[model samples]
Target: MSSSNARTQERELTFEEVDAQIQNADLSEFENQDDANAQSLDLAAQLKKVCSVYKVVKPILSLVGNAPFLPSSWKSAVKTFNSVMSTICV
Candidate 1:
């Protein structure tokens, strides 16, 4: 076989090995359901922190976006940002 063809075949084998590893990956792996439950609680606490920050910021953003004489673009951007933040709270 030509050198280029041989090199391509070798690369294919390496890619297949990496693919197998990816196929076996477990994103939320744990030893047992009890461990998974612990992880869930940790994530819930983190989400609560985000919700607290959102509660504090939402009112300020609303006031800025609603103020008279502000540039329309700035108001629109703030409105979009507020909507996005609201979705992440829960």
Candidate 2:
């Protein structure tokens, strides 16, 4: 086989190994549902700290909407920006 084909086969095996590892990963290490819920609450608090900064910056983004020469794509940009913020909150 060509060296390139051999390299491609090796890369495929590496990807399969990574996929298997990801599939086997779990939160079952946690003792119970309450333990998992507590960890999630902790994570939410951490994300809330990051989201506080967005609260300050979102008003700045709104200022962009007031620009006279805003491009047609400005709406799409605003939509995408809001989506990102919403995802972080979720």
Candidate 3:
């Protein structure tokens, strides 16, 4: 009835049309072994990078572990380091 109401109705209809198109579209093109393997390799590379960083930081973490609550100035850093270590250990 009003201009605002008409605009709202038009927007709702546009969304419904888009949703219907997406629901009816074919997705068979993405179902391939090569695609799956590529995704797996990418994930493995990312995990390797994380593991490398952890290895480099692990000794520093162990040194910190020897001093859990050294001083107030270092408490925040120590707490954060310990928290991260605990999370990694779990």
- Among the numbered candidates, top lDDT falls to 1
lDDT by residue (1-90, candidate 1, tens digit) is 569645743432343544554465553333244746656677777577556656544555666777678999999999899888777764
| TM agreement with the true structure for every prediction | 0.46, 0.39, 0.32
Query: What lDDT does the true structure give each of the candidates?
Result: 0.62, 0.55, 0.51
Cα error, residue 90 of model 3, in Å, equals 15
* lDDT per residue (tens digit) for residues 1-90 in model 2: 569645743432343544554465453433254646556677667577557555444444544544448885895687578668857754
TM for candidate 1 is 0.46
Candidate 2 stretches with Cα past 4 Å from truth are 1-42, 83-90
Residue 72 CA error for candidate 2 (Å)?
1.8
Runs of candidate 1 with Cα error greater than 4 angstroms are 1-45
- Model 1 lDDT at residue 35: 49
Error of 1 at 82 (Å): 0.6
